[model samples]
Target: MEKVQVSPSRTGSHDQSHNAKWGIAAGFSASLVGIGLARFAYTPLLPAIIDAGWFDASKAAYLGAANLAGYLLGALTGRVMAQRSSTAFTLRAMMLLASVAFFACAFPVSYLWFFVWRLLSGISGGALMVLAAPAVLAYVPPSKRGLSGGIIFMGVGVGIAASGTLVPLLLQQGLKQTWLGLGIISLVFTAIAWKGWPKQDAAPVHAVQHPRQSNNTTLKALYAEYALNAAGWVPHMIFLVAFIAHGLGQGLEVGAQYWVLFGIGATLGPLLAGVLADRVGFGLALRLSFILEGVCVCIPALGLGTPWLMASSVVVGAFVTGTVPLVLGRVQELLVHHPAQQNAAWRTATVGFALFQAVAAYGFSYLFSYSGGNYALLFLLGTGAIALALLIDIVASRSVDEAAPR
Candidate 1:
């Protein structure tokens, strides 16, 4: 048998597309840095901010809650704005706004200013999340989607972990300058992403539409799942830093460990779940994720202390957060073969996605407040939410199977 040699042109074309895909992934990941840092950094920095008289403990709490509120609002509003423009355009706008909001923190002591910036950051972050994942998913083939999804979500963990490492260094630089540095970093990253990000004349194939069947059911179930998860996790997101500070009586440096653990766990969660979903199907993967998360949420409160506690936090973080890609993948599978004007159906599902997340954020904020600053209570609430989410997964899975073309 004669062996055939591959042509240089074909090899070049393949290489070019590979490069393009990698570029898109990196651009999307870079866009997440500011939000990731903001979300995870404060948990460690809260203690220092309070002790240094930068702000009160209560003010930090309020700022976090406000940020989540803005995130909720941003989610509901992002696609409407996207309709007026492109996701890239919207992303650039949000990034510019986020940069300004972050840099505004240079003043350090203005309660109102902090609140404003936090909220703005939340909006930028939320919009990034709502738009980025789906876009990233679109660039790759179905066969490699699990790996691609993991790579995309890793940005969240990377940003969080980087901030954890950086916050302590910033503290040494002093508060005002530290925040200013972080703000500058955000600006630089955004500028780089804006310049390097690719523009395609065609949108992703799956971007078009969803089926007109019982989408209402999908929407309802999605809303409940998002709401419950948000309720379960948002409080922890906002207050984890403060909780660590007070609960462990550790200095800021030590408190950074929680974020370190959380980031590590969150990093692993999406990758593992994506693979599981690809293998076992989306619904069953989601159910397992929720169960793992439920256990993880409660583990921290089961009187596990210190290093063991950190281990649990990491474990919990992985499963708790990893379910997102699988969910998005399921939606993509449903909509991939839809009609020519796929934007309408896609928009409907996207909008539902945003609103569900918003409701979750809002409801969870209230739950956080009601917990009266008790971390254990917050975790308990998360545990319950996970249980409900698991139930939703089972029901939704059964529905899909029953509704199958068979």
Candidate 2:
């Protein structure tokens, strides 16, 4: 055979590409199992728990909130844990913890026990959201990061869709069986992703020792935008189904169908948004997303009709999942060379998101009750929050430009 030697550069490139693929796969799995299955799977299960007499409706609602609280705590602490341990270790540990939590939930020994497990699962999801993409993206070329990030976040959508579709089928086998089924699925994903993380630990945190003041201002703006965006998402996430089912007199089946549409939109959103971001830039893509989502969010409030309602459900669902990667991508753009800082900043963003999401959940819940189940009010408020987020980003962009040395 003729001697054919591969050049070192080509071999290295091939290795890098291979590693990036596996790393992205791992990230996808992490998000799917941690956030998708761990957090969202609980939503569909909530009514089941109430119906099964496992817990009263009030207790079930409180139990659901426990996960949100744990998510906030996890976001606050994930970066610290990653710093102390390796990113790979922490990421793997969180995935494992999430799987374990799902299995434990199957037992439902008591409300306290279920709550603790649910809380732990939310913590796993929070940590994964903060850590997984950065870990994987470190291996991806900068040019391809937008699409790769979309792929990673697409897991959330997949999880959402699965919860809507699969959970019902799993419910057929019984509630405990459904929990076990989710746990098994999670465990399978964990095993597949076990060795997919990058072999080396993440780079140390010395990239940007002295970030500029403008960067600080921009970051604060991003945080506020993200927080408010979370608030904006609350109405659709919490009330869309009920609004359709009872508020519109559409009935439960029709409401669930809308939710399925939301899930489908969510599943496709990240990819579409990522591609748009890649072509138009994250900043512009993000602004466009907000505008589109804001409009869609208000459609229901306008009482347009079924087609418009469907559009609202789908677009809002898409933006809810799509905005994640756009924000994360924007963070990377802001801190291009600082991997550690990127992780830390993303952690802060996730914390803000979780915090505001919880607040909005409660606030909107109260408004819904106080307003006598006025779903349109909640949707309009959500739109206002999104519009405010857009305004903040616009102002922040101009300020950053003005502060730049021309």
Candidate 3:
């Protein structure tokens, strides 16, 4: 089906000067497979992988880090790849790679095999993040960028929700089937989105004649804040269910239920953030998201009952998942003149976030070891990182008005 822009025509019909809606859907499906299924789905699958006797706990953790390491490499590599290839090609290729990776995981292979597939999946996902959004938003009017981008970003949350909701049921069947199921889902979405991308005939979607010096201070600050978000968001995505079920004396079933709520919040977040960004500026929307996420990060520590814990789950889910598109909107606006830099900047932000989260995931173990199971300290550390991100955004806002043109 052809996606139409929301504008009316001068001839008493719709005027789609651009296929704005299709672009958004293309970006959305790319993101859904990339971050949503490729990255976030790992957390939900961890237990199943362990139960399937693929790796010990230590090796499993290491394998998880391998995925992040690949994400870092992919982010850097994707920037260069985007300059050389069409978004339609790269997007379709990555989807195929991701589908292959998930299909490979279904086998009871050696640890190295699993590692390689996981790494490939991460690379595919990271590249899409770098390439897909800009392709979709390139033709969208500035006024619609936020909501359109948000819709695309909502794919991540949708993927998350699918993993949280579907994985558990898949686990009941077996790990092999779960892996196959995920691969099929990726393929289905990829097929649906394949035609949504517009063909590029003039220049590559991310072409650059020369490397130019970047002068956008707000862009840099946004990148830094984007990095910091990894500290707060990843832990909850990976560990919130554990802390809720075990740390708070709830059972694994209870934790699983809460995770679904988190996924639900994530699923809805991008749309909400998109609307919010449209109403308020991207900067304000981003700042508020970070602030609210900080509060949510600390919410688990108050020993709140199920009600409060559930609320925290939703808010944390929404904010953590929501911030990506919101930040991407700002990145787009800043580099609107230099479309090539938009891909580079997005890749740079992902690299920072990927590397930080990879290191933080490992580092949190030491904090966990030293505290003798005081998971609260780990949560505190996460809160501190978010607080610092919030501070940076606030300080940057005061010193440099984001309203200035690059």
**In candidate 3, what are the lDDT values of residues 292-402, reduced to their tens digit?**
888888878777677887888899889867888788778877787787777567767888887887777767755554566577787788889899888888887776765
Identify the superior model by TM-score, candidate 1 or candidate 3. 3
For model 2, the stretches where C-alpha displacement exceeds 4 angstroms are 1-10, 204-208, 211-216, 245-253, 335-341, 366-374, 398-406
How does each model score on TM-score?
A: 0.84, 0.88, 0.85
Best by TM-score: 2
Candidate 3 Cα outliers beyond 4 Å, as residue runs: 1-20, 201-211, 214-216, 245-252, 332-343, 365-374, 401-406
Ranking of candidates on lDDT, top first: 2, 3, 1
Clashing pairs in 3: 28-152
Global Cα RMSD, each model? 4.6, 3.3, 5.3
Where does the lowest 10-residue lDDT sum fall in candidate 2? 205-214
The residue-by-residue lDDT of candidate 2 on 1-406, one tens digit each, is: 8998889999999999999999999999998898877877676665567668999755665666677777787788887898898888999999999999988988979888988988898888888888888888877887897778888888888887777677778888899998889989999999989999998765544566545333477788999999999889877776676577667876545666777788789889999888898799988999999899889988988988999999998898898899998898898788776555776687778899999887787677667657766878988999999999999999999998999899
Clashing residue pairs in candidate 2, if any? none
